[model samples]
Target: MENKHPYSELGYKIFFKIKPFLKKILRIKVVGVENIPLEGGCIIAANHRSHFDPPVINIVSPRPVIFLAKKELFEVPVLGWFIKKAGTIPVRRDSRDTAVIKKSISLLKEGFVIGIFPEGSRARPGEFRKPQPGVGYLIEKAKVPVIPVLIEGTDKVLPVNSKFPKLFKYNIDVIVGKPIKFEGISSYEHIAEKVMHEIRKLKGERHG
Candidate 1:
């Protein structure tokens, strides 16, 4: 399956225009953004806590990022238009969507950055969910660097069951961890664990 909506100049243009407003409203503080490579295909594995996660990454990232969103989001009214224009790929959860996999591979090979929430679903505050294996599979298959990202306070900004964000009421932090290379790693689950471990460290959580 070919990617119908690849990364576009328009997306970046729109993002740059709205970035300042978003940062002010969310009080977003980004750290370790320099850890992101200047050029290359890489996977950003992040912990999901709120819908704001994707926008935070897009605004803070040094490069353009394409994320795999659930198929349902693409059916919405205005959101569907924006996500599609931003080059988001629609994925069917809990199943092997061959089209998504193929499209991801194609984008990676073309030196595009991909963002993935390994948790597979948003977790509540003070909760940690085990990561799904799909991110690991992509890491192993893409054979690219994986950067672990930790997002904090988005849950408070826009928690589950809430439509509008509190806006300027909370501070959000996006911490980017060092990239992990999967050159000789063979186990997808192990690689996924390692990625999650880094995210935990960024969140100041202990992991053994």
Candidate 2:
């Protein structure tokens, strides 16, 4: 695997050491660290339970992840600095940013793990919906492996719009399924649905 992300060269100690303690302090248990590949670039499609999802994923995994986040997140000053330094790319939610797409492809080609949340929105409790097509776009364009990750009990741990996180112990389950591969998808949407199905299977019936 080649290093495509600029942050790929940076150390993982900060994210690795901090996440587990934070999770333990906050009581977020990770069960699938072994599921994440130790090397090479692959697309990790995880269920979005909260704003905490990205940080949680990075904290638990030993390998560095280059996340494709929405452009709006870049506005926060200190956070924006760290994300930029982390080899994260921002995409405009409303319009297609050719530059963002190109950069994602380049990073994938360079063998950096890129994460795409297929839901395209935050997770809602008692409900699961079809995934958005952006994930397929990346998979098809990059021709990489798609790792299906199921995030359970995250919504309960940190529900959307809670204002602040609770200190109570809550289980955050991460179930990683087998990688999915596609050959010459007719379109990006097709690739996305195919990937979403694999994720759905892994995410069946979330329990806290």
Number of the top lDDT candidate: 1
- In order, candidate lDDTs are 0.85, 0.74
Over the stretch 1-208, how does candidate 1's per-residue lDDT look in tens digits? 5544485676688888888888887899888888888798888889999988898998888788899999999998998988888889999996988788788888888888999998888998957689888778887888778899999999999999898888878888888989887666678788888888889889773322
Q: Where does model 2 exceed 4 Å of error?
A: 1-5, 8-11, 204-208
Task: Report how far residue 28 has shifted in candidate 1, in Å.
Answer: 0.3
Alpha-carbon shift of residue 60 in model 2 (angstroms) = 2.1
Worst 10-residue lDDT window for candidate 2 reads 4-13
Candidate 2, backbone clash total: 0
Candidate 1 residue pairs in clash (backbone atoms < 3 Å): none
- State the lDDT of candidate 2 residue by residue for 1-208, as single tens digits: 7754477354455666576677777665555556677777778888776766776677666777888888887887777878877778888889767787788888877778888788888868745567767667667777777787777777877788775666576766776767787876687888878877777787564433
lDDT of 1: 0.85
Instruction: Return the TM-score for candidate 1, rounded to 2 decimals.
Output: 0.91
The TM-score values for the models, in the order shown, are 0.91, 0.85
Report the poorest 10 consecutive residues by lDDT, candidate 1.
1-10
